[model samples]
Target: MALRETDPAEVGGYRIEDRLGSGGMGVVYLARSASGRRLAVKVVHAQYADDDEFRTRFRREVAAARQVSGAFTAPVVDADADASRPWMATLYIPGEDLGTHVRRHGPLPPPQLRELAAGLAEAIRDIHRAGMVHRDLKPANVMLAEDGPRVIDFGISRATELAAADVLTQTGRVMGTPPFMSPEQFSSPQDVGPAADVFSLGSVVAYAATGHGPFDSPSPYETAVRVVDGDAELDGVPPELLPFVQFCLEKHPKSRPSPDELLHLLREGELPDPRPAAAPAPAADAPRAPRARRRRRLLLASALGALLLTAATALTVLAVDSEPAPSAGDLPAGWQEWHKKSKDPNVDEDPIDADGPFSRCAATGRSLVCAGDDVMATRFALADGSNTWARPIDDTPDELGSGDLGTVIAARGGRAYVYGADDRTEGDANPSRYTVQALDADTGKVIWKTVTGDGQEATEPNSEQGYSVAVPEGVVAVYGAKGQQYALLDADTGEVRWKRPLPDPDSRICLLRSAAGNAYLVCQKWTDDNVTGTSFTQLDPADGRPRWTVTVAKDQDVVGQADGRLVVLNTTGTRRTITLINAASHIVTTVRMSEPQPESATPTLLNGTLYVTFPSGSVRAVAPDSGRRLWESNSTVESPGLPIASASHLYLASPSGRLAALNVRTGAVEATLQGRDDGGTADSSAPGAPPTLVGDALYVPYGIRSVYTVDMHTLRA
Candidate 1:
């Protein structure tokens, strides 16, 4: 394959070298990073890139690739769905597909055939153990890399608890190659469990051993039918392995042996003597990097990261490499290291989920309460960092996005309130029976919890996404709705001050805060995956009574309250505008943009101004009412999280924990602090959550389970 004139020269910073192949979905290209790391970059076809569903599947594919990590699999290196032409990169293994090899070289001898079966079986086992099924495992998807058969292409893979994640397989539309597809895939694609891959592996091994498919048909339709009710044509398969292949190609999915069983069958007496660990199968004319260069690159893994500095984590793999172990000498004034009683898993639940998502602690007057990857919730004395109490969450967090999505933990008045769910002991199946708990932050004890109506949707906290909780004078007021239910709960006492039915099932109730006041609840509706409209409902928590309610256009998103008016951003599509709406008069005015809007910019409103941070590290300030750009600062930090505003300063953090501050009015850099490049676990999501600014201190959390705070007063312009 060669480069075409239409293909872009580069994608997401990786320079395209040559086209590896093109398929129905995208084109795979040989690419190299600035660090000289060879990669297989797949750029989705323009037609599919425009389809939202395709983008989602690609996002899921990146997520699925992160869940797996083994010597047998090609690890995902980088991906950006938000890019104009969405692309993903994985470590490049120079090799040919198993099918391509058999086609050019003919059938494999028994010894190599046995190794192929073992490698493919192991690859399937790794995917299955990750609680996912690689629905499309055909000869074409199996790459005979130098390190063994690396299972590639997870574009159609889905996890086991897929009521929410995957809709493609659940719909049961025909996917994957007809001949290699399992029988169950034809009838119950949604429920085609891990065993489905085993059946495909049998067919693949048979094809490699013989020269043709077990169920060869003139058409895909006939091939699918034969897959359900037909026997295999195993004439050319080696006699010694025919029975095993037949067992794998069973009409019933259950009849097929598991990956482990198949591995045992192939590796047992098939080898006269114990075989040393099988390395990558060497095939003539396979794509190969120079051995000398490859060896040198392996030795320079640590120092090679300087070339990857463009992205805070492209993993820069500064996240993947460990620095010298931190000692007490490196600990802050009173900080000390502590671990949860429960052990940290070898791999995190999700890629973006750091060892601690909200690694930063919330200062509760005298003590600090926090939640993280290893320690579910813990408290320590600010004076000495002595562990007051520590609580470890479930080994595998109940919610997969628990860390990626904003996590809420607020501590005040000597009582800490953490967001979580409390099952009614009647099984966790019914969402209606579930209650959102406000636990005592200090001891991990349940202090108060609120039960919603019919449990229509999962409980989202007073955190960023849709809802918020505020403790004014001792009573906590929570604003959020689940299903058709909304509640103003006493977060401390667990009492419902007011409850009412919401308008839409897809609406998210957000409590907007501003310098003026924090008494407004903004509910935004989503229809067909699009934010349709927003309604502002002002209320009093003391009486749980409504003050007034107003509705705005479908495209508007309430950023915050400004000068006694609701400041919203109209996100209709590619073009976005800021809209200011009067909560009382219901008058709407659109603020004109002084500059082009950045793609996927995270916006935060402070006082009467809005600050936008782009992935490229550009910060912009705009007047909320006028939509006028005040100033824009090009930052040195390549990747930054969402910016949070303090009185006169705007603060943002990089993946490496670098913190930057700028003047809210001028958008000029005031101060910058370098962060430690602590090696973090492999994750595909954004670098990490933004650092939290509380009172006069900025707290930066890390994946290695530590928090470093700096005094804002020390930063000088």
Candidate 2:
């Protein structure tokens, strides 16, 4: 039953203007304070207020809410949690709840998804920092206001002391809505922490994108069971968001992403706003001298002034018009094509051009390099697509070989690198031998041949037999059993200028810079048990000598470098934390999230923004400097390969061979291309390979032997 509106004269010293809404817990009334400030007052149900225990809980909730409220949250205006009827008031937020919005409109667009994720992550981070936890984070608890998202209703929230009290009371009682609850909340509520919120966030995001929870069931019991034991049905959920959601919903609480981490993941591509230094707290019991009294009055005035300022800012934001979509002609020119190798006969070949299989191709300055199951190193003219060279590099018999010969193939700087294993020999007992060949990018002529040796030799300590090479600024950095080794080489002549070998054989070398006459290497050594012990060192190209070294945990991966600081992600496959190390000062600042994201992907840093991908395929743009998430996405595409981003678009290649382009600024899908079939596997053969971008095109490959070069301008159309 709905609560009737009460006249302003009867309720406290405030004027009740209208009935806002009613829920099981309370009836919310729109009211005005003495200064005419709008507020939403929630008067508890009469029956609940009559219960002493419920009243105590309400009071605790109010305290907790006040302790953690911030810009991303609805701040408490006034509350009488100890009153006969127990009522609370918060700054009234004018907006639709995420649940209602999704139900009214189908699904939130990618831009809105990013905004929602960033806002919620910040809210949760603030709550966690205050030692409070919002265990009931759901779509209904989020308000999508014009300015930003506002998290509301901490009725079921728990703090240090209240958490213990609620645990005792909820020993046998269900404490949360089943569909949105984390596994820990149902299995062991007392043990639940910030990770519980991450699980709920995943559900909220799922609902926002598809109007259904990850584990939607016919009954509450079934839903709980599914959440605890079943795999989430990801039918309509974007692939990119899947990995993130999966990480959030990990059965282990410690594996979930923290709120700060989530924020970083969401805001992957923008500079973070600076966080104001925390104000010093006043002494608890200072003497009420004249100065103290005056200070109190000043504080009150300042708070009121801040409120007015916020109100004015809100009005200004509301006055702005909504943005419109770009027209068709606004898009760039050029035909876009995507190639997917398929096993299915019906779709294995391109319907338009059956002149053999659609080959994987990339364009150079004047030529196109292509490869396929029956071909390798085929060069074509970029102007007219006329063939200049076609060479068969793979000579192994098809039946005994792994289809296309080479993997980890790349072409750049007028050179091509290809990796392929030698054919099985008669009665051979050793693992396959691999080979690396450098070819002239234009003429398809072999420049240098390096036998990678047998897999046994490749596994030898300090052996450089089977290393993957990367040329950053003309310097070739190689990773092999012999550890991280690099040689400064002339880009055109392939002449070695200087060479150096890393100290640790098991060290994973992440090449950061090979330009500006210096190269930076992040070397991470893993213990036998898989714990990371990392260190950063700089080397001069002129004379390979270590400049300085700083120790770090190996579990972290280097994300970016800025302002002489290194940003690293502390990931444990189940949870993530961000650590910022000032290289010169050797000071480390660790920012832990309220929720743990276990399956968060490696962070991509572009410009000042860091893009983090989750196992759920959700991508988040964050600012490492300010520890803030800028954006998030709902239309994530799942691919084993990492998404590549330019200044304008984020490019993702689907396993089924579709290439999707999203606006980098807004996370909106600008264009999509269903790839031509060329008999490729549905899954990726090389999971760690990032999509390569050259000029205005992107090069990507699936399990099939063929690769593809897609026009970026056409993709955005």
Tens digits of per-residue lDDT for model 2, 1-717:
234544234355668888877775777888888898989888887766655556666777787788876789998878887777788898899988898899899888767776777787788888888887888888888998899998888777778555542422332123566678776565345445777887788888878878888888654434644676456776676665665566566554555667776666555632134321111222433221112221121222222211112110010000000111123222113324544332211122221111133224444445455554334456544333345565543334222222222222445656655543443445543233444555676776877654434542231111011123334434344424322455544445546566677564333423333212235555545443234576766666566677777777644545556566777665333233567777678688877643333232446665556666643456677666765676777444554245666667887665445667777788777787775466445321223234555556566654443455566676665
What ranges in model 1 sit over 4 Å off?
1-356, 359-361, 372-376, 393-406, 422-446, 451-462, 471-482, 506-521, 524-532, 542-545, 584-586, 678-684, 715-717
The alpha-carbon RMSD values of the candidates against the true structure, listed in the order shown, are 16.3, 24.0
Per-model clash counts, in order, read 7, 55
- Best model number under TM-score: 1
Q: Give the TM-score of candidate 2.
A: 0.43
Q: Per-model C-alpha lDDT, please?
A: 0.57, 0.54
TM-score of each: 0.50, 0.43
